[model samples]
Target: MTAPEPTTDGTYRDRIIAVEPGGNEFIADADRHGRPSQLVWTWASPNLEFATIFLGVLAVAYYGMNFWQAAAGILLGAGLGVLAHGVLSARGPRHGVPQMVLGRLPFGFKGNAVPSTLMSITAGVGWFATNSVSGAFALSTLFGIGPLPALVVVVLIQTSLAFFGHNLVQAFERFAFPVLAVIFALASVAILGKSDLGAPAFEDGVGGLGGFLLTVGTTFGYVAGWAPYAADFSRYLPKTVSPVRTGFFAATGLFLACTTLAIVGAASVTIATDATDNPTDAFTSSLPEWLASATLLAIAIGAIAANAINVYSGAMAFVTTGIKLPAHIARALATVFFGVAGFLIAWWALADAAASYEAFLLLIAYWIGPWLGVVFADQYLRRGHRVEGFLYDRSYTNWPGLASFLIGLVVSVLLFCNQERFVGFVVRAVPELGDITFFVGFVLAAGCYLVFCRAKIEAERVAL
Candidate 1:
């Protein structure tokens, strides 16, 4: 459990333009620099884009929630996710490793591969593609340069930032914070001014408890999706950093940005309800030409900010999968691989962005909910224990944790999934129950892990 020796001279400490060395290795003490306050921007800047806003749009436009209903659901769901994010972020400085590496404590080295690979794919290709499409659409809307060309431009900038790695990613997010925040704030005001706050839910939408829960799940998916990457940013901070302040700032920034923008999306859709085909264009159509243009630029910049983290953390997660590669270049190579894969996926997704995105958001919550369950349960059981050595112990295995996770995932999805492609029997039988798969999965996984992992964790604690 002893910390890794401080290697190198910390040359990349403040060097934003430099390619960050190492791939999911323990961060040396020399490299541990940055304040907890910086997390505010690190978290905030990414959510200041159209993707966050679109979550709200889906609540009302797709999920039959009234503005107030959507707002309440957004608050409940996003608040839960943000709380989890703060706790995870607080673990970073103490661990000095990527979140997926820390995940070894729960799922063990080999078993951890399940969630690690899932995170790699979800964050890398899934989110990368989602944001890339949004950014490209914004560019096309702003400049009439067409989607393909705009996609190329967006992908290159984000991929470059991610390729250079963490320092550049953090710096870019910090730099982008003010610009994206200001424009989105203005757009929110304008959109709200035009919105009908008292408007009733859409008749054709998924009304009642089903609609409300769907809204909650969608918003939860959007915000909580960032939880796995929480430590990836904070792992570089000095160990002396206050966990409370770190969690507070990270949670505050995420809550403020995500809630405000999503509310704006819900409000905007009250006026532009028929925007299913092109939600991005519909979102900005209500604003003045100048403001709209500025908003489009912000969305594009925000996409880069968001995807940089996606690709960076995705690479980090990919490396944690026990893949053999030159340590120095493993993460960088993974970054490139994800970037290319994401670009191709994004191109295909642009054809049906709205429908595709709704499914993607919900899909994120499906696995994440159960994964969070197992990890949090494991973390709780191992409290006050130093298990850092287990991270590098390739032979360590936790099949019970793995079993619980899969059980929760499969059972919940089978009974409660409610997507366009598939609806679970629970919803099919009782339509008002809504899609509570995330809630069910989380409880099932956490309960199962707690029961199954108790003896193992006790043995581990005694051994330590």
Candidate 2:
């Protein structure tokens, strides 16, 4: 696990080509490497893909917001998520373990299984599937290949990167960053060049305040999807690294990439009315053929960049479930399993990419909001207390955390849900309210956890 000494040039580190060892275990001091600023590209490259762009597309194309309105939602939504990401990621170097593994502090090794299992499926399979669809579409368009075959190619590449593990993932992202950034920047210019920036909100669409809120939720959902995986990438940084720098670089990268691309997506739809039929193609339709082809390639590469982290962190989340297996290769094996599952799901989802993507994004927000509520609340309660032992304490249980999470989830979904599949009664009665389930869920869960866990957390602190 030993890493090479930092080079004078500040460029070299561990063998990026080697398969990373361990499964959600604490990264040893000898292995800890890299600076905080590098987190920028590590977070940015992934969001440069079409999946992120479609978030904006959904705002203008489906949710009926004008470009200006969509931009506002994108900023507000992505801004909040990015801020949370910075705060969460700042805890990584101190913990020196995968993000999900830290759940043991609040939920206990056993209770943490709930969120771990969900994240494993969500990040590994759900997000993997979601991003893969866009990548496959790009490949299919670029190569004239069938969607299924294109998906297979994309999945294999993404999974292989995850299977090899962290260093490779970081290196890939760094390599991908410049390429993705340049192409997306050019495409955005082209898209905006043809856009009607003054276009009004569509009358037939969701429209007005409801449309704005939904757009906000959707964009937040997109960024929130990355929240749980924050520390997984940063755990290898030296403990002395500045948490502020770590968070700032990561958040800035995510904010810039997601916000910029989403705005481009909103602008693209101003001209490409066929966005509903095929988002990826419609996005590139405004550019010249050569630039469009390059943009398509960038989109495919960006998807792979995003899913590398997805599958890797998904495996890390699964391992945090405390499931016994061949300890050495558990993460790698899980990566393979999830990769296959994601491919299948992606295949099924290709039939209706636009609808499926929108649903998946909002669903991510629903669960993640509550989970984050409990995590953040627990962290706040346990502040100034040394709770590292709890990370591996099987007997350590925090029933309050679990209770708060479930209560928040159930109550919010039953009251404020606004999805097409199942609108909550409250939302149904007031259709213009849109979805605030994620926000309500977070507040409820956090408030509940603070009330229920205070005495217990204090007692645990005193015991420590």
Candidate 3:
């Protein structure tokens, strides 16, 4: 099957076979055919992988929640997080720009770099490393190879897929989904059937209102981290696609996959006598040899799926930061640069996976919460207005957005951050409040932006 060529009129479906290897410059139109339903598999497939499972283990092993309690937290937190994801995704077809680029509307062309740069690091380096370590460990377990060798293998595959760019990434996700679903479904049954669902909630005197709230926050962070990149995948769909349908499919896919697998992780902890020391091994150890090997392979593939998005979006974020380069070259180079940086971080993370993973999730929530609040607030203020002209408009800069975002971020971290690395003053004083950094940051940023910038935003819209 020959691949479709880029249209002379500049409207084309992304090539499934050819290397896309370009930044978001042109808007996709009706000629670029895709359904809202494809968003489901595109979002769901990568998340169905093992890193999500590790989230559940974090709740049960570290946060000290019981199987049932952790499950509830996972469901509630993931549902809320993915809802944001869906909303952001629906913007893709409307703008036909990368998520970070669309951020230019709210942040201004120059001010957009702040969030774009942060997202580039978080997605490309932070998440890339986090997911890579998990994939590397799975490879090591399967082949008895050293972690470094397995990591090299994992990074190579992930970067290559991302380097090929959008269409291939979408294709890979669609292809991987059914296989991942089946394997995880089987693994879930094997793990959950033997789990002690009624296990003590306070195994080491860790169960309390604080623990439960922490579990919810951590889970929310894990899932909500994807909000920034939500529109990257959906931008190729025709603009006429129903926003409601697009958001629904994306949210449903993410919520179901993350919740179900996370619950499986929680349940695995209850049954595994050795305890959840190494989440990767603990998860597979209970299954039969054939199933275990298959699960490990699925996890490695799943990591690739997830990392592909990370690398691609990281490149988009990098380019969106006012860097002037040929779109294809810039995106490809950014992919390699971030992939190398992520590999180094992955090497460091392997030394202390659990601690690093926990800290990473919390750290993500700290920044992303404020970022989301500002972005969503900006969207609501616009009321479905299109600002494609400002996407690349270097002269535009919204100081209010930047100021509001910083205010929200600072307030949230100072008051509600509750991580092992750094406990906030408020959390220290009132231990029961747990980590509400995400909630505080989001609300504060949105409120501040609305209060301080609404009139200005309205005037700008009228001018446009």
Q: What is the C-alpha RMSD of each candidate to the true structure, in Å?
A: 1.7, 4.0, 4.0
Show where candidate 3 strays beyond 4 Å: 1-12, 275-277
As a TM-score, model 3 comes out at 0.95
Report the lDDT tens digits of candidate 2 across residue range 1-464: 11221112222247687777657777777788999989999999999999999998899879999999999999999998998898889999988878888887777778899999999999999999999999999999999899899999999999999999999999999999999999988888888888999988777789888899999999999997898999988888999999899999989999999999999888887884443455677778778999999999999999999999999999989988989877668899999999999999999999999899889889999988898999999889888897676777667788778989999999999999998779988998898989999999999999999999999989888877
Kindly list the per-residue Cα lDDT of model 3 for residues 294-404, writing each as its tens digit: 999899989999999998899889988988887558888889899999999999999888889888898898898899899989988988564656666678788899988
Identify the candidate with maximal lDDT. 1
Off by over 4 Å in 1: 1-9, 272-276
Q: List ranges where model 2 is wrong by over 4 Å.
A: 1-13, 272-276
- The sequence of per-residue lDDT tens digits that candidate 1 reaches over residues 292-356 is 99999999999999999999999999999998888779899999999999999999999989898
| Candidate numbers, best TM-score first, in rank order | 1, 2, 3
Better by lDDT, candidate 2 or 1: 1
lDDT of each: 0.90, 0.88, 0.85
User: Any residue pairs clashing in model 1, and if so which?
Assistant: none
The C-alpha TM-scores of every prediction are 0.97, 0.96, 0.95
Best by TM-score: 1
